[model samples]
Target: MSEAARQAWPTVRSIPVSAVTDAKPPGRLRPARLEQVAGSSGTGRDTTGGGTATGVGTAGAKPSAGSASSAGSASSGTHARANPAAELGFSGDPGQHGDAGDGMLHAQRAWDATLATNRLDNLGVNAERQRLVIKDVTAAVGLLVDGWPADVRACVQSVIDHTDVSVLALDLGNLDGAGDVLDDLAARYPDRVAVWRVAERPHWRGGTATWGESRAKLLRLDESDVHVLMETSIVLRGDGLTPLVAAVAEGAVAAGWRGVDPADGREAGPGRVPALTGDLMAVRRSAALSALPEDANYGRNADLELSLGLRGELVVPQGALPVERLGTHDVQADYRERESQRNYDGVLRMLSAS
Candidate 1:
C-alpha cells in the first residue's frame, strides 16, 4: 500500500479490543474468542490502508468520529454484547412494557389469595356481631345553653322529669342568670343534670356558644351514646329526648325537630331533612362527633356542614315531641345574623365543591 493510502486508512490506536468485539453482529461472533481478546494484553496499535485489515474483519467498523469515543468506552468486552433485555427474557410484546402486565397479574393473584383466606361466611358473622352490638347501645343527651336563666332552668327541669338518659348542660358566659340557674339545677337534679360553665360569650346567633368549639369541648368532656344539642331557647313540652334518642337508636345517625325553615318558611321533615335544626337535635355520639370539622368556627353554619359531611347517614324527626320556640333574645341579634350568613356561605361553598 502507498504511504499516502496507509495514512488515509483509519488506525485502531487507543480503541479498546472490547469495543471491536461489541460491534460484532449477534450470534455471528464467538463469545469465547471475545473473552480471550479482552483478557489479552495485546495493546499494540494497528495501522492499515485500503479496504480492511487482516484478522480484523468488517465486524469492528468504526462509527462516525463524533460517537466513536462513547461507543469505544461502552464496548469493553464480550459482556458488552450481551443484551440486557434478552437476559431478563422480556416479552417483546409492546403491551408488556416495564412488567406492567405482570404487576397487574400479581395484584390480582394477591386479591384472590386474600379472598381465599377469609370466607364470605366469616364476613357475615362479623356483620351480624356488629348489628347486635348496635342493638345494645343506648343514647344520651347534652344540653348547650347560655342565656335566659329561667328558660334554661325550666328546660333542664323538664328534661329531668321526662327523660331517662343523663343530661349535660354547658353554660356559655352565663346568661339569664344562667350560672345560678345551672347551679340550682345541678344541685336539684344532681344525677340527671351535670353543669359545665364556659367564660366566653357566644359568637353565633342565639345565646348558645359557638357550635364548633362548644360541641368539640362537650364531646371531650362527656361520654354519651347520643349527644343531644338542645338550644335553651326551645322549651320541650313532652318527652322530647326519648323519641329523639329512640330515632337514633333505630340506626339513625341523627334526630331533631321537624320544623319550617325560619328563613324561607319551607316545611322540613325528618329522615332526610335539608338540615337538622341545631335548636334541638339528637346525634349518635360517634357519628356526630366524627362529622365535626377540625377547625370550624362558631360563626358559620356548622350544623349544615355536619349534615353535609354525614350525608348518607340516617336523620329523623321526633314527630311526637313538641318543642315550643320561646324566641331568641336581642343581645347580639344583628351580629348573629351576619355570622349566620357567613356560616351559610361556607355551607354553600362546601356543597358546591361536593
Candidate 2:
C-alpha cells in the first residue's frame, strides 16, 4: 500500500455486538416499523435472516394489536402529509407525469374511499339509522259548497279512516248544505275533527270567503308537526298521509301528491316545476305559517308561489299516494280557466322580474 493510502485508513477497533443488538427504536413502535418498511419494500423476507438489523433486534417478536393499529395510523398520516406519489413508489416529481399521475392519484383515492366504506359496513355502522317519527299531523280542508255534500262527506270520511291526523274545516257559507255536513262530521268524530263555520261564501262562487284568508286561518288553527292543505275534492284511496309526513320529516319544507317543476326557466308547468301543487300539499307547520300569503284570492298558483318561497326542498311522491279526486271535474270551464290564468300570470311576472 502507498504511504498516503495507509495513513488515510484508520486502525480497526472491535466493538461488542451486544451494543448494536441491545439498541431500541424511539417511542412505543419498538423495531416493528423497520420490519414494516422492509415488508412494504419487498425486502422483509430477506431481512428475516439472523444477520440483519431487524432480525437481530426483534427476532421472533410480533406486534400487538394496539401497536399494529398505531403504526398503521402513523403510516397513513405520513402518507397524507407527504407526497402521495412518492409513498406509492413513483420516482421524481409526480407533476411531471401530468394526466397519468392524476389518474393514478384519483384511482388510489377512490380505492381508499371504497375500503373505508366497506369497513364501516362490516362494523354495522349504518344498521342503526335513527328512525323519524313525526306525530300529530293536522289536515285542513275548506268547504265552499261548489261540490255536493256527499263529496264533502266522502273526503272527510276518507281522512278519518285512512289516517289518524286531526281534521279542521272552514265552512264558507255552507253552500249546497256542505257546511251542515262538515258540522255533522265534526260532531260524529268530535275528538278527531274540528269545524269553523262562516257566513261568507267562496270568492269563486260569488260569496266572501276568499281562498288565501281562509287558508291562513286554517294555518293559525293547526297545532301539529305538519299541516296538510287538503282540498274538499281530494279523497284518499289508501294511507297517503304517511308518505307526505315522512318526506317532511326527511327535510323537505313541503311534500305533495302532485308537483310541478319550473318549465324552461319559467314558473310554469309542462316543464320542470319549482312548486308542488296544492291539491294535497303537506307542509311543515312552522314553515308554511311563515310563508303564508294571506291576500291571495284564488288558490290556483298561490301554492306554487308558496313552495318557491320555502327554504327547503319540495317533494311530491305521486306514486306513493293512492289518491282520487272527487270534485272540480264538473266545475264551469270558463271560471276555472280565468282563475288559472290569473294565477299563472302572477307566477310568470314573478319569474320574469327575478
Candidate 3:
C-alpha cells in the first residue's frame, strides 16, 4: 500500500492470542483492514488482528453476539454492574469517591422541607371564618343585710384577689347595709364587680327546696366557661380558680372543695367521698345549664343531685384549698335534714326504676 493509503487505514497492534476451535488455511497470513476484524467495533474484543480463527479476549470486554438470549443477558449484566445511586441521577460526594453522602443530604433536606410545609399548612387560618372571643364571667351574690356585710365583703375580696374571674352581687333586701357594702365594693372594683338589687328577699332556708330559684337566677345572668356557685359565707384563701379550671380540663363536669371529703386532712388521698358544696363549686357552663333539672327546688341537695345525675362523669375537689366558713344562718341549720331527705328520695327513685 502507498503511504497515503497506509495512513487512511486503521492501525493494528499485537494482542495475546489463546486457543481457537476453528481451523485455518495453510498459507502465509495476509494483512486485513481494521474495520473487517470481528469484535473491533469499540467493544475491545478484537485486540488481536486475526479473525475468529485466533482466539483472543480483552479484559473487561463485553460478550460478543452468540444467540439472542445470550446477547440480552450480556446487556443486562452490564446494567446490573452500574452504580445504583448513579442510575438514579445521584452524584456521590465530591471529596469521597463511591460514597452516597451527597444523595443522603439531598434526601434529608427534601424530607425536612416537606415537614415544614405540612406544619405551615396546619397553622394556616381561614379568612372567611370568625374567631371566638371568650366573654368575661358574670356573678351574682344573694345576700340579706343580717350584719354579714363584712363576711360578704371578705368572700367578694377573696374572689377578686385570687381570680381573674369577675363577681356580681345581687342584694336581696339586706337591712343591715349588706347591699350598701356590696355596692361600695362594686364601685371600688367597678371592672370586676357589679351590684344588683332584687325586689324581695330570696327564699333560701339552708334546704335543697330553693335550688330551682337560685339556679334560675344564676342561669339568667352568667354564661361563661364556668359558673361559680360561691356562698357569701365562704372566703377563699389561695389561687382556687386555677385548680378548679384544671380539674375541668381533666374532664370534670364540676369541681369544688368541702364538697369532696379528703381522707386524713390531706388534699387528696384514698377513701375520698364525692359531693358538691355550694360554698365554691365551679360548674362547667354547658353541663350546669343543660343537666341540672329546672323543677328541682331543694337548695341543700341540689349539688348532690347534680353530681349524681352526672355520674360516670368527672367531679374533682380542690384539695386542701383554704376557705373560711362564715355564719350560715338559715341554710346551715337545716343542712343535715335536707341532705338526708334528698339522698333518700334520689336513691329510692333510682331503685324503683331499676
Candidate 4:
C-alpha cells in the first residue's frame, strides 16, 4: 500500500471481541410521571414534540388505571397536583380577561374548556370570538314580572350589556308595572328590544297568558336561527348566551344552563340531563315551534316534552355560565304542587318509553 493509503487506514484502537459481545444496550428509558390533580378532570391524550409517554405515574412510582396515587404517595403527606393548563403555558387567570363590552367571560370559559379537552394550543382567542358573534341568535325574555320591578330592569340591562343578540318580550298585563319597564328599555335601545303587550296575565296567576303559548309565539315571531327561552328571573353576570348560541350553532337542537334527567320516573339532577331548565334555554326556533305543545298552559314539564320530542342533540354548558336564577322563591306552593304533578305525569310518560 502507498504511504498515503497507509496513513488513511491507520491501525484501529482495537477493542476486545468480548467487550463488543458483552456490551449491553442502554437501560430502558424511564417514563415521565404525570402528577394528577383533584377537583378537575381532563379528556384526550396530550402530545408534544419531545417524545412519547409510555404511561402516567408518580415521580417515584407507577400509577394505576383507577387511582391517581401509588402506594408511596398514600403516606407522602403532600401532593403535587399537576395543572394541565398551567403546565402547557396557559398560566394566566381566566377571570382577568376583561371587564365588559366584550365576551370576556365567554373567552375565559372557552380557554378552560380548551385546556380540559387538551386543545388549548389548537384553538385561539380569535376562533372563540368568532363563535360569540352569534348574529343568528335572538333572546326571548318573558316579562312575567308579577312583582320584582328591579329584576326586570337588571335582566334587560344584563342582556343588553353582555350580548349583541336582540330581545323579544311579552309583557303580560304589565304585572307589577313590568310592562312599563320593558317599554322604557325598548325605548332606550330601540333597535335591540322588541315588546308585545298582552292584556292576559300568566296562567299560573289564573289569567290567559300561558307559558307554552307565549314561548311558541316568541318562537314564531323570531326570525333568527336560534330562539332563547329565558325568564326575567335569569340575571346574567356574564355573556352566558354565547355558549348556548355556540352549542346550537354547532348542531345541538337546544342548549341551556341547568338540566334535569329522569330518576326513577321523576326529574333529578347532576347529569347531562335531557330536559333543559326554563330559566335559560336556547332552541332552534323552528324546532321549538314544531315540538312545543299547544295545550301546555304552564311551563312545568314542557321542557322535558320538548327535549324528548327533538330529533337532534341536546346540551347544557353548565360550568361556563355566570348566571343568577332569581324569582324561584316567588312561586306559590299550591300552584307549584298542582302544576308539578301535571308536569311530572308527562315526564313519567316520556321516561317509561325511553
Candidate 5:
C-alpha cells in the first residue's frame, strides 16, 4: 500500500491465523486474546495485563449451547423467511452499520454508504447458469502416499478444507509413518476420506510400487466420475478442483490446472491441448484406468503420457485456479532426473506419432 493509503487505513491489531489447530483436528479453537490497561484482561479472566494491545472484543465469551440450538432452529427455517440477511448479520439499516465505536466509520468507503446498504444478493440467483456444478457428477481426489516427507497431513487437510469431494489416498508402505497419518485422517473424516494401505515401497523412492501401478490402483479404487491426480506439493487456495471436474463433465477426457504442448514446445491452454502436467490434473476415472502408463516409476512426464493416450479433449481452463505449487517432493534427485528424462523420451515418441 502507498503511504497515503496506509495512513488512511485503520491499524489492524491482530489477525486470526487458522481456527484449526494441527494437534487437534476439528477442535473448537480457543479465542481468549488481548491486553489493555494495567492488569486488565479482555477475556474477562482475572489476569495481569500490560501493553498497548487494545481489546477487539471478548471473543473468549463463547455463545451458550442453548443459543446455538436456537440459531440452528432459525437456520432450518431460513427458506420460509423473507429476510434471511437479518439472521446472517446483514442489515440495510444505517444505524446497524458497524463502526469503530462512538459512530466513526472504519474507512471512507464505509462512509459512502455503498456497502452499508448495498444489495449483493446471490441466494439462488445464478443457480441454473453456473455450469461448474452439473448435477449427479461425483468427484474425488486421488493422491499417492509414498512417505511422510510429502506433507501428507497438511495436504489431506488442505484438500478437506478446499473441496467437498472424498479423497482416495493410496498409501504405499507408509514410509516414515505416512500411512499412519492417512489412517488418522481417514478416521477423522471417515465419510470424506478413504485409504488403501500397501506394504510395498514406492518405486520412485527406491521401492517396488511403480507410479503407473499405484495410479491405476487409485483409478480402480475410486468410483467417482472425475478422479483428480494431485501431488502433495500442490496446495489449493479455493475450490480449484471443481472447475477441472466441471471441464470433465463438459465432455473433456482430462482437464488439468496446467498443460504442455510438446509438439509446439510450449505451455498449452484453456482449450484442447496435447498433454497436461500432473501437479493438479483431473481425469475421467474410466479413461485414466486404461491410459495411465503402468510401467512408469515416476510422475514427471508420466502425466503427459497419460494425457496423450486419452482420445478426447484435454483442457486447461481459462484463468488461474486458486492453487499453489510447493515445489516437487523430497525425492532422490538422481532418480527423479533420470526417470523424468526417460518419461520425456517416451512422450517424444508419442508426440512424433501424433
Candidate 6:
C-alpha cells in the first residue's frame, strides 16, 4: 500500500480474540460515539450510506409526523463526520487520481465509480459530526406465508417494487406450495429476500405452530430497529412502509396503516387507538421483544393483544398511504370464531386489569 493509502485508514480499536474458537464474523470496529462535552444534550444519531431512518431526531431535526429525517446529511448546525484522508496529503477530489504503483488495482473506465468511491483522498473532515456516535438503522417487512401462494407472491413482489426494506418471511408447512414460491423469490432476489421454513403448521390449519410463536420468531430473527408486521393479504401501490417505520422512530411503540375500537370493533381514524390492526403494523423491535405475545394461537385478536401489551403509544399516521388489502385469509370459519373468542377473552382480561 502507498503512504497516502496507509494514512487514509484511521486507527480503529478492535476486540481481542481469546484462545477459544468463536463463530463471530470479522468486523471493522467503529466507535458508537465520540466523547461528549459537558451539558451537551444526550441524543443518538445512527447513519450509514444514505436514506432517512427512524429514531434519529436531534435538537434541530424537525421530523414531520410519521416520517424521519434523512441520514446522509446532518440535521442542522452540526458538521459532517471526520475524515482521516483529509488529514493526510491527498486532496478529496474525484477527478484527480494518482498512480497505483504496486498494490493498487487499475480501473477501466473514465468515471471509475468504484475506485472513486473507495479512494481515500475523497474523504473530508467534519468537526461536530464526530461528537455523536452514529449507528446504522435497518428495517424489514415481516410476512407470514401460509396457504395463500398467490397472495404471498404478490405481497413480496409489491414490497420489493415499492419499498427499500428487505422481506423477512416465514413459511409454515409449505402450505399450498407457498413456501416454494417464497424460495423462488429468495433465489431471484437473494439480497432483498429471506425465508425461514417450518414443518409445523399454523394451529388454525390443524398443525402446531401458533400465531404468537411464529410472530415472535420473526421478531427475534430480525435485527432491525423497526419490524413491520404486514400480512400477505396487503399489497402496496407505492412506498407505504417508510412512514410507519418513521412513526416508530418518532417514539411510538407501534404504528399501523389503520386501527379499530376494541369495544365495538369499529374502524378507528388516524391517531392513538386502543388496539392496532395487524394488516400493516410497524413496531420497535425492542418493544416487540418485550411485549409480543408468544403463546397466542391465532392472529385474529392476538394483534390487539400485542398492541395492548406495548409500553408506549400506539398510533396510525394521519396521511393515507398507498396500501390495500385484497381480502381476508381463508381460515376455517369454526377455527376463526373459536380462536378469536379465545384471544378476545385475553384482551378483556388485560383491559380489566389496566
Cα-based lDDT for every prediction: 0.52, 0.57, 0.47, 0.57, 0.64, 0.65
Q: lDDT at 288 for candidate 6?
A: 76
Count of backbone collisions in candidate 3: 10
**All predictions: root-mean-square deviation over Cα?**
35.9, 31.9, 40.4, 28.1, 23.4, 19.1
Residue 101 Cα positional deviation in candidate 3, in Å, after optimal superposition? 35
Each model's TM-score, in the order given? 0.56, 0.58, 0.50, 0.64, 0.63, 0.63
lDDT of 4 by residue, 133-187 (tens): 4543444443334446778888989999987778877666666878678778887
**On residues 1-354, what C-alpha lDDT tens digit does candidate 6 reach at each position?**
233321211100111223322123112212112122111111112233122222112222343332212222333236754642222222466663544441221212222432343232124121122221112436789987778999899999999998778999878777888977888898899999987766667788988778887887787677676789999999999878766765565446677888888877898745556689888998777667767778888998899888888866676655467998988887889989998999999988988898
Worst 10 residues of 4 by lDDT: 8-17
lDDT at 75, model 6? 32
User: What are the per-residue Cα lDDT tens digits for candidate 3 across 42-141?
Assistant: 1112335343311111222333364222443455575664544443334555553433455544544444554454344335321001011112222233
For candidate 4, the TM-score is 0.64
Question: Largest TM-score belongs to which candidate?
Answer: 4
Candidate 1 achieves a global lDDT of 0.52
Stretches of candidate 6 off by over 4 Å are 1-136
Output candidate 6 Cα RMSD: 19.1
What is the alpha-carbon lDDT of model 2 when measured against the actual structure? 0.57
